[model samples]
Target: MDPEDGSGWADVSDRSHRIDDEMDRIVERLRDLAHTQRRFQDLLDAVMSVGRDLELPVVLRRVITTAMGLVDARYGALGVLS
Candidate 1:
């Protein structure tokens, strides 16, 4: 906008609002990235936890519990097929 008459003030205001809206979108995307990263880390930790056990019974239980925790499920089960 011209400093003397400020004839372009409306255009400048519109551009500023657009930029602010774009910034908000960018921030939301960053938050999503952070959440995804945390979930990935949790999965890695669960893998390590299951790996550290050498007993079959303990391993199976850990797998079920870990699956439930990862998916936020109230119930989990294990099925065997031969």
Candidate 2:
């Protein structure tokens, strides 16, 4: 088939569309991975912060604050059961 033939053009167009679709999927996966990494890092940091304090009250306060921040909650509390 001639390079300038319409048949060749259709093949090129199809390949181009496939490449674009694949690239879009790759970009979406990368975004999701990045989001997951950030969430993991945040949780790790929160855990580390709570662990750094050996005092019970301090640890509980840090845990509560971290939990509230993670969930975007306006308020949080830790209730101890006797």
Q: Residue-wise lDDT of candidate 2 within 1-82, one digit each (tens)?
A: 4676578888888999999999999999999999889988989999889989899998999999999987889999999999
CA shift of 59, model 2, Å: 1.3
Tens-digit lDDT string for candidate 1 (1-82):
6878887898899999999999999999999999999899989989999998899999999999998999999999999899
Give the poorly placed runs of model 2, Cα more than 4 Å off: 1-4
**Given candidate 2, what's the lDDT at residue 29?**
100
Worst lDDT run of 10 residues, candidate 1, spans 1-10
TM-score each candidate.
Answer: 0.88, 0.83
Q: For each candidate, what is the lDDT?
A: 0.94, 0.92
The TM-score obtained by model 2 is: 0.83
Score candidate 2 by lDDT: 0.92
The TM-score obtained by model 1 is: 0.88
lDDT of 2 at 73: 92
